[model samples]
Target: MIDTKKIRKFFPAIKAGRIITNNAASTQVPVQLLELLKKLVVQYDNVHRGQSHSSILTTEEFESSYDTIAQFIGAPSRKNIILYRNATEAINAVMYSLMTEFKDGDNIVTTFMEHNSNYVPWYGLCKEILPKFGINVEYKIVKFDTETGALDLDHLKSLVDQRTKIVCCSGASNFLGTINPLKEIKAIADSSGYLQPNGDKRSYLLIDGSQLVPNTYVDVGELDIDFLVWSFHKMLAPFGVGALYAKEELLLKMRPFLYGGDMIAEGMVSPEKVAYNSLPWKFTAGTPNILGTILSSQAIRLLMDFSLNPGKQKYFMTDKKLERKDVKKAMDNIEVHEKILIGEALKILGDISSLNIYGPKTAANRTALVAFTCKNKSPFEIAEKLSNLGIESRAGCHCATLAHRYYELNPPASCRLSFYIYNDIEDVRKACLAVKKCI
Candidate 1:
């Protein structure tokens, strides 16, 4: 179990008595990251564009940030990692980069539970962009069980055929809080007899891990994930930095999504000929978010430290290599902690006769978030009332618009309360009790 009493001290928001239960949208930044930002600002300089001491130092830190990110996700190396403005942009990068690879009759498979970011790009590519180019591609959406909020694996298998080129799925649903059965999904994708230019006989798998990576352990190598994308803000850092992890071979073959300045090799751009930089950098065009990248990487380290040893600095602010065993242990602890919190929340919220909670009934089947609707109250009204009681809650579709509509929600919205590492049992009790009071 996490030492929430010690861990809560690191967050000024908690100290200020604010109930930060809306962690699914974005987690609160810790004091260490804020302090680290100040130190970084003093010596900050543009990376890879200068030859001064500050530039050299900043560049080293910025580049090392990629290593930290790659290690956290069990990526082979930094070559597989690319930083973006956010997860939406990172997923868009995959769509754009692989745009030319889609054939006239190929189809893309995704789920109704996806955030608009994961679904819309493919929708635009298949319905809008590709059609104009005389390349007709189809986008198929998998269905979920409305009652359990679980993906319909049999339905997904039926949808995926030889014509399917890529399968894009969310690692976890932001609204339903359902942690998808990724292994089963991967097996289904693997069985698709879609031929690829890379000589693979299966459709590619792209996981939108925005909700999964922040709260659970993810091993890209073990999962054989072709592409993974997530935002750092959802974890613990300030906004503006997201990550895309693609196979090195795929990164080497796929064209860069953006092309400009740093993306090109040194002295290789001329009127006669132009050559792009090596893997990863080829995708990182123009000036990147240097400070945000550094802070985001530090946030991963700090998250590990917070989970493994609260009120201590074993990984944060250190140059130590994160051990795989430690990563699993830290993340497993966080998962267990969240299960307990969500379990308690489910029990309390379930007792409210007027409310209907969405997603899995048991905490073991979902993440730490709980989304629900009230019979006598609108979600917005409930959220505002909860806020008046100093409890933070989010009321909306939560970006799982298709899923919200799947439930036939009148307004396509629900109120959500989510927990994180710094949140304790008391926070969960208070948030759920406040929801009861609001209703």
Candidate 2:
């Protein structure tokens, strides 16, 4: 029910006669954001370090950007939000911030379906960092069902115990396109009898929402999540900006991941002691990505406008506070639209006998992406052929090496075609037919 014809007009990539279906890796930038970038270049200035008129104006936009991002995800406030280079850095921030809190026998529980960003940091922490300090921390990886691509919750329950410090999982699988059951995962994390330094009796839950947040609505307060990380690049903005939403209490207790200028309090540093800045700022170090932050926040507003009323400026470039109802409606529309697109894709791609599709069989249980391997064709060859046919697709592990290895793929790869709001049914049809033709 999304007016894809109208939505496609906002993207230059679509107008260039190129099919952009590689959205799981990164979405194409909209023309509005491009124009907004041009306008921002005129008055660009470093925030929080200058007294000039341009600096003050730019600082206001940069700081208000936090408010917009916080509002979009139903975060309590800007205090709980921290901006990073990308989702990988955000996850690393959590790992580093809580590095010292791990006990000798503590374990971190994660899934086999996680992207490297979610798994590697914990791996490095347990294998490389903690052992140097004589702390014998362990990491446990939960398994998923190979047939349905569903997470094995019973196995996750068996892995978690009193010693489990944190539970990390992806909100959706990039390769399988599986939308994980977060509430169920949260419940499992809560039941773990791990006593925390903060007097909590459960493991902290961190969700890597790089795939989920961009495609669906996520409310931090409602979910009671300890940490959430995602990249704006996958959500329609340009690269160089990612987000971390943690509980304010947890952010206050954890150490800063990076430290330098801007993180320290103004005029508070002395030879004896140096105090850090307030919440959110404490985690942000050095000169931040000023223009990227502004454009990224504006992208959220523009996305709502694109879903609700295309070619209209109700939310974009405005200072109005985003209502929770409007956010839900906008995201619900997107989820529904994606279901239709993925449903059509599943129907067409399922008919190919040589193609073996991964993830949920139905659109209701997954995101708007499909990854498959051909019986006689290499995934790389299929992707190259699709590119030659004017279609965009991704081939490789898609940074999902663990999942690919789980399936026992020799090259540990698959060809992926992902859809976004701007992608139409015709695009899905052409892309699937092209895959059939390629194989």
Candidate 3:
């Protein structure tokens, strides 16, 4: 069995008696991940344009992170991975790229269950200027039954049609904790690895992997996703860093969302002779977040292989030593343990007549996130009450406004308690106790 205690030991945030159940909002940073950020802040001063040894070394470290994360996700290579400020920017990059062909009549199929980060952008893109570009974008949301969050793949098939251009979805929902049926959805779209005169690439299946990346080893090749994005901040990395993965040829086609220096190969003051930078850099203008990227790299490396502790430094990069199967097995083992904890929590919470949960009825189709509602208590009030009891939980809509509306939870929202690989039975017990106190 994977040693969860050893993993939990690395996250000092658990020291306070608060059970941090809001992992869907933000995860507890492990000590190893924190140290890498500290090293970047404490020692490194250069970002992007530094020419000194520290700058060069740190740059190498930052660029190396792109490769490490790319390899972890099984991307074609690091070149396809471009650094952005966060998942929002990453999403914007994809939307901005689509500015060219999208017209008023064309529809984009997305879901209601998306975090605002995913939902709002498409909404804005569809509403704001799509008509000017001739695209009348319509949202075909996928909501689940109150009994379970088994995503409506059948409903999705009905929405996707000849006019549909893009299908954006979350790799995993942040609130309901439901894994989407993307591959199945792709099959409905008739989107297979199609023949590209330039290269092999199918239509788009962009996954917002923000909530799913740190917990899962997602092989991009296996999924055949046309695009994917996630936040480094969520993945035990520093803030201000995220990734946008696109087929290089597709990246070559999209327009830059923002314009500034470093994005242009050479541009003129006048429009007479403006030259945009080639693939990748064409989208990323100005100086990049080098330090954050470096920190993110180190953090990802540590999570991928925890043995690479900073000072001790001998335990990491089993990239060669340990096969991907071993890592998946360890993660799988931990997932099984988490499922047990979730079951215990459900059984305990179900006994309380006032309490209710949203998502899959069992752990079979669910994730670590447990979203619930207590009668006569605002979800936020429940969360605050739990906080006072030293139980850290999430309240409000959990950024899943669509789910809030779909579940008929109304303005009060639902409480979310998510666990990572590190959590044990005791944490579940504490959460149960805290809920009792809150009630």
Candidate 4:
């Protein structure tokens, strides 16, 4: 029921005969997003904390986008959404806050499947602030059965304990498209995995929602996550913006990670005192990508709505929701078709005697990503060969070194071909042929 024909018209990259398959690295921009971005740039002007007409309009536009994005992900309100440059900034906001909240002997829990952006900062904090608090940084550890490459969930549960203060995790592995059960993870955090003699929850759960929003509906309230981070670029918005949604109490306690301009209402850091703003602007320093944020709203409006239940309509998050029924159905249908196309590609590529598919066997357990290693071919070699064959793919550790170890591919792992709404059966067929030719 997905009209790939009509849908294909919106993405110029897919129509260019390039056969793009590197959406995991970056998705091709839709004409909808592109046009919106173009409009902003053409109508460009500076925006800052001022009373000028242009600044007022621009600031309003930027702040308004937060509401749209909040709605897109079922956030409580625009006030809870903090904008940033990318997932890294969004993750940093939470990481720094975690640093402020915990003391020695407190613990933090995460997995190896996290992108370096998610992994490195926490580790850095563990080495820095955790020591002062006598806190131990524990991990669920990223491991896989070299044979199956499935998630080691049992191992994950073992890592949570009485002292754990934070549970931050990626919603899906960017490398292998492995979808971790956020709902289950949230439940575990809510109850601390029955960690007590009678079982009392001990950690606040945060989700790195960058990858999940594109693949499915993201209702943060439904997920009951304490914090969630997502970048606009990954979700088809401009690259300069991302959002961090956190619980109100946590936000109140957070010391500003970055400080300057807009962050302070009245400043008197006169060698003796430092004053700050009262609201969310405490964390926001200086002028932002006001135009980019404005245009991001336009982009968010243009994306597909993943919900289907008509009765669940009241739970819809957007203030100006995309009222078009056809677009939502088309988006959902496109996702279903893309899954099938990617699955067929997996079926063909999975059997190549020379190739080793890492991660789940069935596509349902994963997002629309398929990664594989070959007998002796370097990941870059395969990726280059596929590129020469007019197919697009990405290679190397994929910022997922743990995923590399999962397949016993240490230095570099496999090539990844990620599918999107614009990708169709022919594109998958072409990629399959390209992979076949590589062998």
For model 4 the local lDDT of residue 411 reads 62
- Candidate 1 per-residue C-alpha lDDT over 108-205 given as tens digits, one digit per residue, 9 for 90 to 100: 99999999999999999998999999999999999999989899999999999999999999999999999999999999999999999989999999
Q: What C-alpha lDDT does candidate 3 achieve relative to the native structure?
A: 0.71
Q: Estimate each model's TM-score.
A: 0.99, 0.99, 0.89, 0.88
> Candidate 3: misplaced stretches above 4 Å?
41-50, 132-134, 191-203, 266-271, 307-323
Q: What is the C-alpha lDDT profile of model 3 across 1-439, one tens digit per residue? A: 3455566667787764456666666666777666666676755755356678887776666666677667767777776887799888899888887766664566677887788888888888877867666657676676566577777887877777666677788888888778777679767655533333344334467789987777665777778777889987765665788889887777776677778887788544356766777755677688788777766766666664542232334434233433456546545654566677778777777778888877777776666778888878888888888888777788888778887887666683888787765567887888887887788
Residue 225, model 1: lDDT of 85
Q: Which residue pairs in candidate 4 have backbone atoms (N, alpha carbon, C) closer than 3 angstroms, thus clashing? A: 103-133, 104-133, 104-134, 104-135, 105-134, 105-135
C-alpha RMSD values across all candidates: 0.8, 0.7, 3.3, 4.4
lDDT per prediction?
0.94, 0.94, 0.71, 0.70
Query: lDDT tens string, model 4, 38-97?
Result: 666654666555687766766667777777766667666676778788788888878885
Question: For each candidate, how many residue pairs have backbone atoms clashing (under 3 Å)?
Answer: 0, 0, 8, 6
Which parts of model 4 have CA positions greater than 4 angstroms off? 132-149, 193-201, 266-275, 305-319, 322-334
Error of 2 at 330 (Å): 0.3
lDDT of 1: 0.94
| TM-score-superior candidate, 2 or 3 | 2
